[model samples]
Target: MPWGEFKDTVAERRIFQHRTLVALMLLFVMMGVLMARMYYLQVIQHDTYTTLSDKNRVQVQSVAPTRGLVYDRNNVLLAENRPVFNVTIVPERVADISQTLSELQAILNISEDDLDRFRGRLLEPRRPFQEIPLRYDLTEQEIASMAVHRHTLPGVEVNAELVRYYPYSELTSHALGYVGRINRDELQRIDPVNYAGTNYIGKSGIERFYEQALHGKVGYQHVETNARGRTLRVLERENPVPGEDIRLHLDIRLQKLAHDLLDGRRGAIVAIEPKTGGVLALASVPGFDANLFVTGIGVEAYRELNESLDKPLFNRALRGQYPPGSTIKPMLAIAALDSGSTNRERTVWDPGYFQLKPTGRRFRDWKRGGHGWVNLKDAVEQSCDIYFYDVGVRMGVDVMHDYLTRFGFGEETSLDISGALPGIVPSREWKRAHRNEPWYPGDSVNMSIGQGFNLATPLQLATGTAVLANRGVWNQPRLLSDVLGDHDFEEGLFGAARDDIILTDPDTWTFGIKAMEAVMHGTKGTARAAARKAPYRMAGKTGTAQVFSLAEGEEYDEEEVRIRLRDHALFIGFAPVEDPVIAVAVIVENGGSGSGTAAPVARAMFDAWLLGFPAPDEPVLVKSDPGAGE
Candidate 1:
């Protein structure tokens, strides 16, 4: 041990202390540089970093808007929202999806389709933690079973959703239309932002036409979430605007009545208010339930509807095209009177048949024997085919075509409802263009009786009858009265103003209307025997449209012909002759004589709507079941 060694150890210790101090000082300077760089990134560039941070934590979720409600004129609920329990799965939160589904299937009856749809949704690349719908309208048993296993199945949830329901399922189906799931084609057309989480859209009829009004505006919510992507609390929210309700002009009571009256009949009945043009009822028989289409319709049900021979999916009221038949008699009578072809008092000899000059082809009348000499008024009252044929030969087809076309015969009625058909009203020009043939005198005679190349829809016939009831003033038919907004606000949607129709002369319509009245009221009237002392006075015309063409000397054989091939019976009428309210048009497919079959249906509809369900004292006239006739 020496004093010099102790001194050297002391010097080394001092040198080590200086080096440690220098290293500590350098470390502090480097730490300061790092802190300054962090400040620039976190404080100066706060907005950029904040957005990046939120991207990792927060997510945007879509909320669906409440759909609108539908009501009849009397405020009877037709379409409404019903609470439905749905089963859902969150992909990111699920531990074992297959095992969880197996447990779910044990309690609920899950169809093969349900599993496939769920799996398909899972495969799509979407946002993390999105709730995929597993099954809709889960039963109570399913909910209870799921509740017991909710804690174990982390991502599974049971939610209550609003589903569309139709109270009168088939009654207002065609008129109200239906809503269905949004498909790839529909999603392209819809605004993804506006639709938000909604999956259904209006597919047809009035629902499709007024989709904007029925689909409410979407809203937003800022929700605070946990690390597991579970909602902790709603930080801020903006409630979605509820869609406006729609009130229809249709009378549900009358609609039901008409539907029942048409029971088993393969035809259409359209009744409208002559003055206002509000359709009381537009019933097409064999209607389908609209609820089946609310969600995705089942394959079997959809196939049945599309393949049915009765064409349940067809909107017969607006789209069915049929021959006007003898119903055009009133229009012919007006044309004859207006064109000076005959006077109201003019008389013609009815020899039971009419012959074309030179060709000498005898056109046989409905009556095998003669109707005897009859005047214009008497001929119309009795529905004498021979008398009309004679007048038609004189009037000519070219003239009749021009006159009938003016009455909206060849064009669509432009009804408020969709899918209206414009029936064919053939002119000399049309015959030449379409058939490549010349219009002859014999053709004119057939057109006179509404038999040759004359066609119309039920809606057109009803509108025409309404025009006659209102004395040539045509009002466009409307099924919707107004659209109702929030706070009970209403705006007139249809029937604001009526359009005047083209007619030869006002006097001619009056004469024809009076003649139609005689058909139901006069002793010789064809429809008189069938109407049988109704409570209110009715003005009507009965028509029997031929279904096929006969050979040179052939006649119709009812037994030999199939029921569907038989002539169509038609009747057009209005109630309380002087002040008409409801103009009814009824077409009974292959139903025997218009007076016997079609007029009776019109009578029943009139009595129910105008006269309040027929008094017990009033005569009960029931139409025989259409199936029995077939």
Candidate 2:
């Protein structure tokens, strides 16, 4: 009925036109929204989206820089870079990792250790497409096999790279140290951008101390990759900066001599040039091959090194703690003379033991019957323990500590090597802190004789001997002779002595030197018999450090004790005493007597350096010259 009422032709035509216009406007609005979205994606976010798309086919890779070279004082190559082939894989690009690994094992020898290391890396947080090394130093047969299966294996590749190598690895292991795979701890400490491509880092010694100078700048390249993430070609590259070449003060020839002299013996020898404070030789017996560490050392090989009885991994030169024994006699004699406690002419009557009071504990001397009527000179020459015991009580622990500290006893020598320990210089305060007890008169006597709470590293003994050689001039020992970079010798690139060990009366130093000289040449000198064949005059002191103390009523019998429990033989000396050149310290573990076991090693070292062995080849590495290339 309503439709019939509205059936006027003109009104109906107007209503139909208005509804059609409204529908057309709604369609146009939808088209405008769709066009706006298309424009935003095509123009505003163009670069961002393009980059994401290209990432599937392109990569930005890091190029490792060539590491610097290392040379001895004579320009002999100590550390070098050699080319090695490695088998690597990109995890993301591999289709079936388990199947691929199984196939790979069938073609080559992959030990459980190798597989374990690879699996460990897979679990680590690393870049998705980074090349993970599986086996280093791949053989020719392995390379050929990899080539035959190249097409089937999409992500596997054989990469060639330079690796760190040592020529005389065993000889330089302790001094030069060695490089090892960078662990997670080291990675977190290093700059990510700088160490993007680096895999190895210095593990110890010189290598660790100078890591900054040894690791060069990183570089980058834009690469075109395929579907399997294989590098098709390098599009653009920026070259990296090479590291600095280092020339050491160490004489490899002398290092070898020291090693040979201590053949199969557990001992340490540290020799220094007194004038320049350059370390000439640092030898620790039973050293491991440094090359074994460059690439990840095998599990068995590492186990052997870690479980060795002689402790080949231990750096005896830098960290060995032992009783200085009689080596401290000359130092104590100086303390006595300078402190007004005693003089070169002072004498003490010894009946084999010492007592601070009229009736007290008897401090037994090395001689059973005691050295009777011995003076300062005779005490040092004969290493009379009783004479030192008498004076040490009078000097007190405070005086002894002060004098020894000045000689670099309680501190590190700052020898430009890592892990050097500070030998203890015991005082009342130190005793209270460490031993949790008060200082006693007997403690003073023991300190005076370089025993009891006293401990000295081989490095410390060498440093103290250098002070005597320099005649009170405290030249800090250093291993870096020259940094083959912008450095000036006159400017003192290495370093100067911290300061001279100034004393009130400098003549006391001469008195000390004279006493040391008697120990090598005097008739009753402890080491005279050992030094009889020397062509040159040497000043030295012999000491036997007790590994285990004897009770007041007990006596030490060597045959009854274990070999490791015997005394540690020690000797400190300098050649050409009048004008000293080389100062050395030797320590033989479990050696019965210093004069017999340790002095011979020192004599042999002096003979090698002074009496002359074959010289290093021509063109000895001279500092301040920059043209020398690897």
Candidate 3:
């Protein structure tokens, strides 16, 4: 016990108290800093963090509106919506995507294409916990099978939604068209907010023409979801407004009749009501089932359709460009009379052929010994080529082009359907632009026969025929008759009356109609045989267009060539000549004679529309018009 160690106890105690006070002050400063940090996070930044946390559990979902229904004039459903089951997966909930996909493959029988498409979607930008579809349109058995294994799968879900369905798929595919899944390109172009939950988009025909009206507005809902992102309850909802219904002017019965008439041929038939220009029936043979394109068509099926020899996917009625041949005679006759190129009393001698320049080139008429001294009426009724050759040469290419353009040739026609192609009407500008050659006298002569560079679609021919039936009052051909949408849209949306084709002399219409009538009722008319058994008078014209060019001086012997290389047969007509009802244009590919093949088909349609369709009960009206062809 040293004296210094024992006596310094009070001083050591004071030093220890000083160290404890310093440590307490430092501790108090650290606690104060931590409290301030906590207050900043919990109070000032509270809303931001809470919103982030709630988004992980609660979700705002887009609700797709119901698509519109499409009906024919008789209320027959052409296109409708049907509930289809789709299997979707949420990537966030899927713990091991590979394992989950394998399990889904076993349960859903997913194809390799489905997996590829799913992976492609996964690469694209999307909302959190959004369902990505793996397969569409599941069968009842598949749905039941998925339900049995539902508990085993965490992120998988079976979603039900309405999809487009065309009941008369083959019959009305060209008229109604179809919808398909929206693509990346379409996504860039479409309204993101409006099409939020929408998947399918209209691809062609009427469906494409009225896509906006058919696809209704999008809706929204506040939903509470669990940790796995399953919707537990709907907190608030805004109901969607459904799409409007559309009614077409097509008559199913007449459409079927037209189809039956052109059953075996690879040609098109377009029939329109003379008054309103409402298309009664538009048929292109060898059509495909339009449903194959709705829900992501398989590569194999698409390839098959794309490679088919018959071209079932082609809309021949609107897109097919064929040589108009004698079908142009009626239009030319009107042109000849109205343009002051030729008079009705004019006549031309045909020694079985025509020449742009004598001893230059001989363009042989269809008959070896041609029509003798053909007049304008005889030229149209018999479809005499030599008479037109003289007139066409006299009028020249420019006048013919201008006159024919007025008749809707070489133009888009501006129809409601999206597939119409503006057929070629050979002009000096068109020839120089496309063929890089100048228009020649021989070109004019060939155009007279609709041979050289002249091209016209069946729709164009039908439209021209309808114009004739309407007597210069042009009504553009249309399929949509009524659109039952919001704000009385039916009148505004569909069946709009187009501009008329006003003629210089209205009496020229009577002249053309009288000549067309002679085509079926006259003694030596080309299509006179077709009018033989008919109970009603019809104005018609027969046409024969060469499929392959005949070599100089090579005769056209149809039986010698291959079936596909033979001439195309065609006819155009309207029934009950006094007050026309139906105007039709029929074309039969490689069927030899227009009178023998195409004329009969037009006669059948005329009978079905004028006589057979109206019941016998309306006897007075039916008997009022003269029966038994002249």
Candidate 4:
């Protein structure tokens, strides 16, 4: 046993040495592989891994620019941005959107409209991690409640944003219009990068006209976020550029005066500064609050406004088209003189009515027993339909159309006023195209008296009157006076280039002005009562536009016809005939008489703008005077 043990010792030693060498070689190989992997990760793929890590901790966000401020000519703020709290949600971070929305509804008094709007917006294409607004204008209590329950909600947040507000909402609704939330159609048309975080866009009026200058450039920021996607800090920020501030030609004092003048009525008054073509005041009565549409008008509120019989939402100044009535006499008189159809000395016999032929239909004048014989000046002063009927037929449709177009009729003439209609100026072609009928001789007669197929907006009447006031010069009606920033105001926008009217005889302009002046100052003038005791000499033409036509020989009974179907009162005029400062157009819906109802409104506007009397706050009552005729 001792001899066997001694003989195995050398073998055992050799076996142990070999086993130790093999173990050391295996350990060295494992160490080399580990070092190679460490080098590949730390050196070769360093940028890639670092970028991945940062993606989990950081986020890029868009910063919205502040919308431009809007002010009147006197620096009175019309539209402004007010800070508001809104509840927003990030879809990617929410585990269940439906469940989260339910929770939000319970937390806040969210209406079904808001929920529906949110859900609809959720399906629209958007940025990967954009925060969608759920509820707007949250109260402090609602904000506190949301904060208390924030932990349970993953991706919900309360954000402060600048929302549009109108200080004189009711007065300026149709003039300034309003902004609204950007819809999907707007998103597609807008510059994505520039409007990334923007929510509102101009919908109409001054807001829509200068949208590009009002909406500034967007910005970007790098923010650090936690594992739960909550923003911890802003790493880098590129401050956004604020929009350009705009000042309108609108005078707030004059606007208020115009509104007060039309108090308790359904009507419109447009006043323009003739020298500069600046719109001083644009007032549409029974106007709804424009502020209601800023955030989002309630369904019921919007429905009520949309369905109201008074049509408070209608922009009568720019869109309401009606027969110009006898108010068109001044312009037609100029046409007659220029076309050699009639002379200042030419006289037409008016026996209370006119007929194209001896056997033709009798076109009755406003006066039951009209003035016997009248010259051009006498015709204009009396608002005589029969005299115009004679000259209008001589001048023909083509001549009237050409001259009226030059005076800014049958077409949109405003440079910045939006939604203005090119009122109907019936010609052979127009009648053929629209009504599929030939132009009738009676059509020309009706058009001569501002009836039949001829229609015009109050703004158009005002613009035409402005041209007349300016001695055939076309300034192109505009609202924007100046822009207070890098952006400059663009002129001649959305309108044809200006071409001043030059007559064969330059004295025609002077003649037209004098004839219009006679309408206000002359003893037999239709609007003489309205212009009585005026310190300055003004030019005016009053008219009564029929709401419905009478049957062949059927007499008009104002008492029998409903108030809604009564004649519309109209007046177009300008103050201080020598200097020609302000041109105005006034229309009172179903107010009966132009001299009685509409002329007084224009007188008040003139007094306010020129004389600064009967202050805006003064309790001035404008009543219909039966003595005033035409």
Candidate 5:
């Protein structure tokens, strides 16, 4: 045997032993690394991993606030909240979203829009397992059916929600406005944290004006949930601060009366408590159902409302600007009487037409036959165009413009309601600024008659009449009688007087009232036909506002004109001339004959409101005044 061979054998054995030791060391190191990772994940980072796991199981839910209710001055509900059920979903809980949606479509006739909305919502960075709204305002049958088969559905859920409801339907549509689902624009406008759980917001009218008071604070519940993210129990809750309740100045009964008086005509009527500027009834006829807009309105329904020839969605009371027409005559006469530009005893003989002296453009009278010799009082009473034309031309546009502005024409009313239009009162400055034209005597005549660029809203007219009835105590019109909020705010913003509105000259109202009385009771009074035999004395002025430009030789033939192109019949009045209680302004669009059409409606409103005369079944024909028929 050789020694070298033995050594080689020993070397080979050593090499094999070293290789085995290295492999064992590497294996031990790998095991240690794996153990450390296991310990770290299972113990050290347990909360992070567990939260990630439970996120698949647990759910957080919101309980939306119950919207505040709206009431009329008499406590009649105008807008309210009604209970409704909705189908909801959580994306991560859904195993196969497409399959679940298909099943949901079968059970609930989900709209294509609903499915598209659901997909879009799921795409947002949201908690995957949190429930989201699928279908809103589900019927009882729908809820019951969905509940019955909900066990088979994984992520599908049913939630009880409160939806906005309008009880008056279309009666107070424009005044009360409407609420709808909050959108992206609203989201940016609204406080995200406060409106977190809110679904809808007020869009217009009083609703929008008082949105902050109506939209209650958000609430939260510390809810315990099951493995499927279903609510198991509620641990704690912070109750929501419900929104303030609002009591409007509207009288629902009177509102109904005024609405019915319109008889589905395209018109607007506003009645106010003369002393307080509290609107008893403000109605815009041919109004839409506000409830239809509470949720998301259908495109077709929206289009129909927006494109209707009658303009059902138009808020005529706040936004409609019409020429004051003959209604402006009483105010014009008041201006003349107050400014000493003309005396009530002063006489102007009407030969049925007025000529602008140097320019022989005749301003024709509504009466073909002459009103004979008429005093300033008689002129207002008869709405004699020729007599006003003469006095207005004498008073000039400057003096008349200054006086009418004091009565709120061509100005935005300080009413609490939003979106009041400040009508244009054209003056030399305004005409020059807007039209780049010089003022004319004919323009003054037109303005005196409330034509030729002059415009006024029904609210403005009512407020102005109220000021007259209140003897020039101009009260800022307020719709909310009481703000049911926690904090107390002053009656008016900017320290305005709420009561005892003082007029510089109270005697002016007396003179104006006397002239308006003549309009109802004096011989040749235009509105006498409607108010002559009233149980109570009503001092009113009838107005016929031309909607189209009539040629110099053209007589207005209502039948020849389109309904939308006809004159707007206007009337403004206060009842019991000596001690007025109610003031009103009525505008019937394209309704010819203010005395026959507009005055009668105003008479009915006065009877129902101030006189407490129950609504009459038919049009009661009172005896014509000796002054009737202009």
Candidate 6:
């Protein structure tokens, strides 16, 4: 042992004890701080920590309310909700959305539209962990495939949802319209919380008009979820209230009759109940199957519909604007009588045509020789153009515009019909604004007979005819008969009330109706042949509207022109004239004579409603007189 490295056992023991004491103090301090932290978390902030922890295990999910159902007057289901499976994905649980989408495409027959729609919805504002639909109406095979790969795809799910379906798709396409996926515009306008899980919305017609009533309140549930965002159990739930079911005044039997009557034709028919203003039947031919639009119509199929010449999507009853032609004659007679331009005993001699000026253009009548001598009753019965031309000119545009407006010619009058156009009733102001031209006397001459700038929809004509049937009483046309719920249908839903059209002479209504009655029963009545064997009396007026102007001394030959370019046939009438129940307006495009083509259709409709001629399942055989008169 070296002398300098001498052992010192006592001093070494003191140094070792001091180091041991310092290490113990440090460990005790660390342990005290750890205990304080544990106490703070476990006791003081227990609720906050538990809440944070439960957030991972539980989620509040939105549940969509079932859509309402639609029924006809006889309780036939028009529109309903059908349960269907859809492929869905929750983005929060998806590891790689792109990769998952690709995998889904490999397993399913997904189109570009499906991918585009999915991406669109993904970009749209949504709540956390909400399931977005990828493909709708999945087939059984697709569902099985998705089930087999469910474990591999974390966020993928097969969700069953109720989708809107129209049973009589083709029969009621225009009347009921349809539902489709909510678009960006709709999303911005809708309440985010209420429509959280809702996907479809009404697109048009009655569905769109009463959308709020049709879509019910949303509900929610607190669900226990696993690490992969899969719902394990429902902790709490609030069931949603289903929408109110609505019943319409439309009769399916009558509607089917109208459709069958107009089969193979491009035209429209609107039948209304004069007493209640309830629409009985509204039919537009060449209608499409509304089902095609419900589940996102394909691009190719939509293109075909959009480009079709027949215009199957066009709602001719409410939207189609036509010249109205001689259908307004009965209405014009009322105007002339009320304005004192002519009286019931007034007579005009027809020399085949009327000259605005002695040498100016001659407005020829449909009859070649003439209806030599005609009174108001005689003219209306015979559909004599010369008599109407005289009265129309005498009444002029101002008096005619004011009086005809009362008959519902130039405005939308339906309580629930959507997309109805206010037809053009040209006055001095209208001509100045629209045509940017002064109102010429010649314009008045043309408008006097429901030509020139006078345009009216089939619905408008029906409404006007209904007003006539009611004898100046106004019942605004409506489709909503009742709402099947505790909520009573508000009378204010029909909008502002319309005042009755009261004339100075109440007898004028009876006189006008008598003249209209003559149109059906009189020996020389143009439509008398159509009313030949009618059990009940009907008051009607037939009309022929020219498509194009004829040059001076030029004649209109039906054989020389194309079918689409021929004159439109029109008729307006009410059956059982004494207690008019049904008033109708019929238009057959390019069908030549109104008496021949359109009047018979009205007769059939009357028989269907009044007599129930053909059984519900029986086939209809309409006998049309192609060469009948105007």
Cα-based lDDT for every prediction: 0.80, 0.84, 0.84, 0.89, 0.79, 0.89
Give the C-alpha miss distance for residue 215 in model 6, angstroms: 0.2
Q: List the residue pairs that clash in candidate 3.
A: none
Q: What would you estimate as the lDDT of candidate 2?
A: 0.84
Candidate 6 — what's its lDDT? 0.89
The sequence of per-residue lDDT tens digits that candidate 3 reaches over residues 1-630 is: 768876788888999999999999999999999998899889999998899987876788999999889988999998999999999998888889999999887777888878888898898876566778999989999999999998888999999999899888888888788999777788888999888988889999888888887888899998898876778999899988777798888987777777766775688899999798789998988787999889877778889988976798999998999999889888888888888999988789988888876677788887778889989998888778899899999889998898788778888774587789999998999999998999888899999878888889888999889888988788788888887755344345544555676777889999899999999999988878778877778899988888874578766556655777867888898988999889999887776778878888888788888777634343211111111111
lDDT of 2 by residue, 1-630 (tens): 688776798887899999889888888888988888888888888898889977876788888777778888999999989999998888887989999899899988998888888998787766557778888888998999989998888889999999999999999999999988787778778888887888888889888877777888899998988876778998899987766788998999999887876766788999999998889898998799999888788799999999987899998998998889789889889888888898778789989888888798888888888889999999999999988888898899988998898888988876577788998989999989988999988899889889988889898999999988898888788888777875222353345456677767988888888888888998888888767867789999988888864568766566655677777878899998878889999887876788877787787778778878646453222011111100
Off by over 4 Å in 3: 1-43, 123-129, 488-499, 549-561, 613-630
Pairing residues by index, what is the TM-score of model 3? 0.89
Q: Which whole-number lDDT from 0 to 100 does residue 162 have in model 1?
A: 90
Q: What would the per-residue lDDT of candidate 1 be over residues 405-497, giving only the tens digit for each residue?
A: 656687876556777888888778889999999988778888888887888998888988888898878777877777775444435544345
Ranking, TM-score, top scorer first:
4, 6, 3, 2, 1, 5
Q: Candidate 1 at residue 362, lDDT?
A: 88
RMSD of each: 4.7, 7.7, 5.2, 3.1, 5.0, 3.2
Off by over 4 Å in 1: 1-18, 48-58, 89-103, 115-132, 151-156, 436-442, 485-499, 502-504, 548-561, 614-630
Q: Assess candidate 6 and give its TM-score to the true structure.
A: 0.95
Better candidate by TM-score, 3 or 4: 4
Q: Which run of 10 residues does model 5 get worst, by summed lDDT?
A: 621-630
Tens digit of per-residue lDDT, candidate 6, span 1-630: 797579888899999999999999999999999999999999999999999988999888889999989999989999999999999998988889999999999999999988887898899876677788889998999999998999999989998999999989999999999999888889889888878888889999999988888888899999998988888999999998788899999998889889999877989999999999999998998899999888788778889998987899899998999998888988888889888999888789899999879998999888999899899888888888889888888888899999888988888877889899999888999999998999887787788788898899999999999999999999999898989978544557666878789998998899888888888898888888878889999999899887874578766565655676878999999999899999999999888889999999999998888997587678888777756789
List candidate 5 segments past 4 Å from native: 1-60, 90-99, 112-132, 485-505, 549-561, 613-630
Candidates sorted on lDDT, descending: 4, 6, 2, 3, 1, 5
lDDT of 5 by residue, 512-542 (tens): 7888887777676677767756888888888
Q: Please state the error at residue 339 of candidate 5 in Å.
A: 2.5
